[model samples]
Target: MDLHSALIALRDPMGIPFFPWLFQGLMVLTFALHILLVNLVVGGIFLAVYHHVKGGEYGRKLSKTMACCSTVNLSLAIVLGVAPLLFVQVIYDPFWYTANAISAWWAMVFLLVITLGFLSLYVFYLKREKHPSGFGFFGLFALVMVVFAGVIMSMFAMQQLLPEKWLSWYVVKGSLQTLGGGFHAFSLGRFLHFMVPAFVNIGIYMMLYAWYFRPRTDFDQGYLDWIGKSGVRLAKIAAMIQVVIGFWWLFSTPIKFGFYRNPVFLIGAVLGFLVMVALIMVQKDPERYAVPMGIVSLVAVLGMSAAREVLRMGYLGQFDYSIYQYPVNLDWGSTVLFLVTFVMGLVVIAYPITLVFKLGRGTLSVEEG
Candidate 1:
């Protein structure tokens, strides 16, 4: 009847199918992959819109490229999202499902919003070449919708941790408010904390895009230089903003001393800041450090994700709940099979991305915008 009682009632009877740590690890890894692609899609949309409006031959080419890649990125984000969702349900089902129930309407609408967003992006891609002006509006519209969808999902995820507030959120004056009016609470700093770095990530990606095609394409040296220089500058600025946003989110969170002082949080926060510094430092010679910068960016994602898990656990500690407390069924056969299939699926999915990059090494023909 109470929040703690409700959560206990909702937990899976089978408990975790295998080791709790292992599932948690898989969730972090898969979620990192999902968010990385999400950054590309979100950040790629920003770049595409910026370049399209600039109205230059190189700008048009890059804009079109990013617009086209967005559809692919969205698909990959959806694909990579499934595993983490499953793992989350496996380990944190009580929290996850309760959050969904609190915001039931918005939770259901998330799928619809994604479908519409994807369709809008597809339209943007198709029209970008022939109806450039029309596509720009569509692109902007799609970006807003997709971002809203992300915000809703994030709010639900965070809402789960605040079990104590769940009942208050669900009922007011002895009346049920389960519909939630398509609204949910989310941290502005936390949302921007992820969104800002996405731009930096995409900036690094653009530099690599420029570098890879520089030798093959007949693109003007000035244009390629602009790509490299602009990307570095953009990444630097975004990284700086992310630092401020990161701290804002940190201070805003109601963390206990143990969580606030935990080495996991400390190390992750420090490493993330250092990674940004490294990215800024590498900007002086982007071409040489593009690969390393990209890898470090991913490492930052992993570190941040781990820190998030730490915070989640710490929050649950209030109710004296721990993922390790979940009963284990020890289904090793299914667990091993799932792990193998997950790895194989990643390999399969990666092949196409690798081929796309390989093919992208060719010169791009610019369309007049």
Candidate 2:
């Protein structure tokens, strides 16, 4: 089917199919979850590495703590990724299958490589490995590499999914045009926009993690103080960079200006602005504004990210590389089903927040990383 036909099928106000709606819901949920995890891992590692390089006492612990968080986020990233894959298979099956099939050897091999990184991390944590100089460095590097692989896999998958007009299959290798890669499509500003905020988000969470894990000893207090300062500084710098790069990215995309028409995007931008400002303020006294602002900022950041993704996916829907089509109209039953699942997801996510608060209240022993 043509791109125009596919869009009408996707967005017809009249309704859509059961599987299509269900898969779309899964896609959105998983994509959002993956993005959140990306922030944690990407931003977390940068923060960890920074503190290590800057090595003060707190800098030492800060790096390890960030590593710990990065590990957890990596696991979450993998788990959350499953649903999106399934959704792609269900909704854009032919395209996904074709691209993945072509890249099958590499795609299959990536799993083992990613697992190797995680295993290495497990060993480090198991040994409680020391050396602030390299704390979390290898593990973070592994996770980042895995992310790059995923990006490539995604790019190839997407490139295949697009119809002939949006995409022209190139020469012998079947790889789409390249900026450079053994991985995802590395569009300069696009990737940087993806990268910078991830660092900021991770730093904020790490800062909040510091709050959750209060210092147990005088030494711990000294360490916590340093971690907090390092994290806040890194976060502010990263967020500022993201703001600049994000605008630059938008400026590069004349076509996407139409996509930003929804007021929600503007709201997201404003909220994102406030979030960084709050993150900056929190550094001064995390006890006062850091935690609260952190929560608000994280939510705002997530909202902004989600809004962009939704719009992006919507636009991609029209221009989907997938050469397939679903019926017009969202399946009514599927909408209800999605609502139920979404509520369940809210609860699942809420548990961590509750724990975060408990840690804050000292009801739960908030250990310093």
Candidate 3:
């Protein structure tokens, strides 16, 4: 069969199990959260680096602050990834297991590398010895390397495992060489484009978080003038860079033009564009717009990223993996269950807002009205 035909076959699963669409929705939600946190860590670190570098005499304090955020974001990146991964395995066990197995070495060593990265992460702050911001540099390096490894494995897995009609490794390599046009057959190219934006977005979020959680007393001219101004500038610039590089990476994939032709792909692309525009506007008027912009932009990002993953699972450009199929099952019970939780979640989210308003109101009454 032709390459495209083979690709479509990967999506042709034997059958659907359990509450298919509902589980898919859950998987999507969890995956989105995982990516959101991933960006925070990536962008957060570099922003911290930039802040510490520019803070002049305030460098130490700024570094310490940045370190705290970096560590927390890193932790969340790993911790919050559980549900999506489990759900992915449940549905795509063949693809997931096969991919990991082919790149077994990388997958196995990942634990050690992650541990080392964390050690570097801990050394970044836990120790006061050695170089200044010592661990920070190493931690940054380690994290980048680990992410790169994941990229390599993913590429190998996607092209290699997706039920390639049980083709042997050599035949696959031969075909890939003919198809990839002199590029390395097993390479994923994840590291080249994604790492910077990951770091940059995370940095932006941290700065944003700082801005969001600013103490009213400390919301003085200096804070706004120095930190806010500089932070906004860096984050927005990084945002622009991410947009550029993201497209570059997309096109770099063999899939390219046809990839965007997919309806789901188009939706993601449009939402992603909307998000960038919203973020830019918020950057322009941070106080009035930052919170909402950050939120909406994040949603757009998550949607785009999840769709991207779905496409990847389907092998967007080159081939669609046909090992699994999911029927669109309208799950009423699941819908009502999560719908109630969703509304309740809104109320829970509102509590903090209400408390903040109450405190601000009481403080304002004492001081003015």
Candidate 4:
């Protein structure tokens, strides 16, 4: 069968449970949240390890802070990832499932790798007090595992864009390649495009961190000043690198697609540039601009996520596929339940989130004492 026919055949015959647009929108929103926490996890751990090795008074303190935050953010990242994964599977089952099948072994091993990454991070976090510099290796190992997991995920995402190559990857030469051990395609530019922003986001997080703890009697004014300066500097540098990488990835795309001219992509690029400009402006006073810039940065991330979805649409469009054209079974019951559950989840988590914030600021302890 031809590629188009095979794709159609692979799609769920029962049709999707709701409108494709709704799922697509939710996918982008949830993906932004997932990726935000993911950036925190990856960048936080890297900073933790870096500071641990360069131990001094403030460095050790920051290292411990990041080590704790990475564990929490990693958990949230994993949890938030479910919604986007489900939405993508719902709307792009043909591509999503096929990509997984292509690298079935990696898909299966992904869980183990992530688990090891999590444990390795904990080892670094829990053992740092006893063997501060020596345990840096654990943090480094965790970073490698986390990055490798991203590599696997990026490979799968890129694979989904190239349906035409599926058959060849599945049937190498005359023999069937059922072991699914091969990584058939990867786009380093695209992967780095996603990754380089980790430092940017984490830097912004650090600025907010400084601002959040400014009122704390226990937090040194000098340390806060140092964090604010370091954060803005890191953010500015990373944002600049991100801009260059963005253009590199853009130019690497098929010229025929003309993604550079695509309105959605252009808007995303503009938002990214605005973020860099905002980062630059905040360098003089990151603490004062922390909240506003954080909001802008998130909005920019959401815009970029939308642009990512648009790019995916462009890729699948080459195969005459559109989620809008997908069969809809119209299951309002499940849709409503999903929405209700999502809202309830936010409500449930709000208490702990607020408590954590207060604890970080020492307000909770002050009140109790």
TM-scores of all candidate predictions against the true structure: 0.92, 0.73, 0.72, 0.96
CA deviation > 4 Å runs, candidate 2:
1-26, 49-54, 92-95, 127-137, 153-162, 165-167, 170-185, 215-219, 254-257, 310-325, 328-369
Across 1-369, the per-residue lDDT of candidate 4 in tens digits comes to 877788898899999988899989999999999988888899999999999999998889889999999999999999988989999999999999999998999998888999999999999999997887598999999999999998998999999999999988988779999898988889999989888889999999999999999989887999998888888898899999999999988988888877888898989999999999999887999999999989998988998898888888889888888889889998999889988998999899999999888887877865564
Query: What is the Cα-based lDDT of residue 127 in candidate 2?
Result: 39
Of candidates 4 and 2, the better by TM-score: 4
- What lDDT score belongs to each candidate, Candidate 1 first? 0.82, 0.62, 0.57, 0.91
lDDT per residue for candidate 3 within 40-90, as digits (tens), equals 665555555555445454555555666666687777777767667776675
Better of 1 and 4 by TM-score: 4
lDDT score for residue 51 of model 2: 62
How would you encode candidate 1's per-residue C-alpha lDDT over 1-36 as one tens digit per residue?
655666778899877778799989989988888888
Against the true structure, candidate 1 reaches a TM-score of 0.92
Residue 15, model 4: lDDT of 97
Stretches > 4 Å off in candidate 4: 363-369
Which prediction has the highest lDDT against the true structure? 4
Q: Which stretches of candidate 1 lie over 4 Å from their true place?
A: 1-5, 178-182, 217-221, 347-359, 362-369
- After superposition of all CA atoms, the RMSD between model 2 and the true structure is 5.8
Q: After TM-score superposition, what is the CA distance of residue 328 in candidate 2 from its true location, in Å?
A: 7.5
